[model samples]
Target: MSSLTVAYAVAFYVAAAVLVLGLVVKIKQYATTPSPLKIPTMPAPRTRLGVVLRILREVIYFESLFKSNKWIWICAVLFHAGLWLVLARHLRYFIEPVWFWVVLVQPFGIYAGFAMIAGLVALWARRIVVNRVRYISGPSDHLMLALLVGIGFSGMMLRFVERTDIIAVKAFFLGLLRFDLQPLPAEMPLLVHLGLVITLMIVFPFSKLLHVPGVFFSPSRAQVDDAREKRHLAPWAAKLDAERDSAAAE
Candidate 1:
């Protein structure tokens, strides 16, 4: 294996370790029995119609995304859109190419590539300019953005200006899809492209990218927020409370 490949493998493993360990530690910390913090709750909107509207607002608008800073929201939305499109385009590699979709993919792929790079640059600029984002931003956060931007930029380069050997790239990917490691492409540029792609995949499940699923797992978003007024505690919580009451009475 080339030194570049070895370096990518090492970085991927390290990033994976940090992600897994960090998540485990966070889960364990949250699991330990402790009294909940008594932070004052915000005054919920009044009236039946208004409360429903408020809940809809939070779910659809991603209110939390913008609470921190304007640029952060922009970068986040653009990055997400770009990443989605890029992934969508990759479906061509896995599936037999249909002419219509293949033709459609190029335009959107270019747009997504530009958007991803632009968003990353804007985010990095915000990190440098905004006091709070800069203060709170860790090295890993910066590294993640840089890596994403690099991947998009390199991909766009290969697609448009300096067309790499498409045949070789296709074969390499098809081999991967088939659970085989085809011999590395003869061209160093192709190897570099594959290197970045593999690096991103290996790091994906570990990083904040994991938050793609974490968002759904979140209690605040996934759980019903109207529970205080609309519904009782889960049967489990209720049954535990009843057992405690019975024990006390005895």
Candidate 2:
């Protein structure tokens, strides 16, 4: 086996193992922690109308993303669009015989790679130009984006420049899924491209890039719509104080 083959295997396993172990450790930490900080629940709006408006503003307008730098939002949109197309196009790997739809899908896959590369570049540019972003931009952020962009660019090169054999590559993937080590496409370029992609997938769950998933779990977003038609919590805080005093007197 060539050194490239070994590199492919090593990168894939290292990534997979780290991703799994990281998730287990993270979950354990979250589970064992007592809630040390009570989030001061914001005052619920006074009127049902106000609550509805707030919900509409948050859910529809994505007020949180907008509140952040505009470039962040742009990067997010392109990243999502690019990722979706890549994953969707990859389904062709498992399916036998080219469907008529794949013809339409081909250009989209190329476009997706371009989008990912552009988004990553723009995001990196923001980190360089914006003082706040620059301060926060750590090694993991740079590494993550670099890996993603590498995967996108390499894949593009394999498709356009090198013209890798898709069928043999698909067979190799299917074999791997079946726990068989079949001979992969001999195309070094495509293998290198896929290797980086597998690495990104492995590291993704552990990285701050996980905010992609974390947004759904965020308390502010989760709690916003649920606060409808309740009394303002600022008033409730006072009421609770009064109750505590009454209890002391008793």
State the C-alpha lDDT per candidate.
Answer: 0.64, 0.69
lDDT of 2: 0.69
What residue pairs clash in candidate 1, if any at all?
none
**TM-score for every candidate vs. truth?**
0.69, 0.70
The candidate scoring highest on TM-score is 2
How well does candidate 2 score on lDDT at residue 208?
79
Model 2 steric clash pairs: none
User: Weakest 10 consecutive residues, lDDT, candidate 1?
Assistant: 33-42
Report the error of model 2 at residue 184, Å: 0.9
Shift in Å, residue 66, candidate 1: 4.1
In terms of lDDT, the poorest run of 10 residues in model 2 is 32-41
